[model samples]
Target: MTEQSAPGTDRLSSVATAARILREFGKHSTQLGVSQLARRVGVNKSTTHRIIWTLVDEGLLERVEETGLFRLTTTMRSLGASAETAQRLHEAATTPLDELRRYTAGTLHVAILDGTDVLYVERREGPGAIPVFRSVGSRNAAHATSTGKVLLAFLPAERQARLVEGMRLSPKTSRTITSRPEFLAELQRVRRQGYAENRGESEPGMCSVAAPIRDPLGQVVASVSVAEQVESVDAGLRHLVAPIVETAARISSGLGWNR
Candidate 1:
């Protein structure tokens, strides 16, 4: 028999559902009426009004005067500022990252973990590089990318478990390790090795190696990676790139990562 759901699951589900409605509004920002939002979210008019009002009072959504329509507010400015800060930090690491690229002649990327995804903060292409598959502001599954795995490996056990629990481990390629047990084992290996590598896990014919960037407090705040064609990322080449990637990570960490 199937196990019963936990207490508070329904409440959490409702909040998540409501939050998804607000996110849709944030994406569109077309000034939706309460009725429209209610229809869109498949909720009753009273519930939609209550959610909208709560969000408005919290400064997350704004109501248009005279029109009775609402849109996302400047409170999202905080999220933008955070992204800006992360970009600035990536800029600060450019020197080291550039040095790493020069040394390895491979594409370099800086990324930070966001929820269960890795957001690329910056990227520098190397000589004769293959067309980059990722770019600044692009996101990918955290479990499939080298940078993502490094960051995830550093997260607290409970937090890591929570991130993977009940989530679909969708395979991006034949080589992608989508099994939870195998993925956890890989995380353990990353924790022991202090780095991680993805051999065409996300993109076919591409390989990437990454090292975690720690904050001053020793927390893993970001990651630095070098991506190259699979044929170019052999064991010998990995040895050459590891130290450079680690150096770039250290430089970024010095900028204010707390352990």
Candidate 2:
């Protein structure tokens, strides 16, 4: 019992020390030596070495091979940006999504991609609209939704390849793109068109149109979609993709996206 508990305690202590090191980096400049980090975290150099190397191996911190100092990598910035972007997206999208709800008289959603899944972060339903089968904090396959396509379509090519290299594109409906080559083609078209559409692909009687939400850096960080029962969408409204796209642009601009 003592041996088992001792290891757990040590692991917890190491974790706490690692967190302190990261915090110290944030408090000061980005670059710091291991010795500086150890002193800042109030730990001895050996323990600091263990913690720093662990974080380095995990890509949370990167070691400058020449300077032998550490700095936060793009991976770290990307993670932080993703969280901040999500918070800002939620705040900026609420009013716009509400307005979209009034315009479409349907369900609306804001989503982000988490690995191969679309994670719904916000949702609204119009009065008298059919209840969507999704909600905040729910996740579904990225291949099955317009929101997911908008998110996936803007991913860097290498990242996209990494995600779908060996993925099994399962069919959610007969209209779902189940072949990798076909899905890739679809994503290309979505990227060119600046939006994505799902016509009974995710749900048999449901249709959705989505546009990408970009951040200040012009990175696609989220998506907004208007969904409705296929029969309920007016034919004229189906051609009015501008409203949804414009609403997404409004939210993106609120998040500091220029142009």
Against the true structure, whose TM-score is highest?
Answer: 2
The residue-by-residue lDDT of candidate 2 on 47-76, one tens digit each, is: 999889899999899988898899888878
Q: For candidate 1, lDDT tens digit of each residue in 79-119?
A: 76567669666667877776675467777777888788888
Give per-residue lDDT, candidate 2, residue 92: 98
* Candidate 1, run of 10 with poorest lDDT: 232-241
| Model 1 lDDT, full chain set | 0.77
| Residue runs of model 2 more than 4 Å from their true location after superposition | 1-12, 57-59, 73-75, 125-133, 155-165, 232-240
Q: With candidate 1 superimposed using the best TM-score fit, by how many Å does residue 118's alpha carbon deviate from the native?
A: 1.0
Q: For candidate 1, give the lDDT of residue 161.
A: 91
The number of the candidate with the highest lDDT is 2
Error of 2 at 28 (Å): 5.6
- TM-score for model 1? 0.66
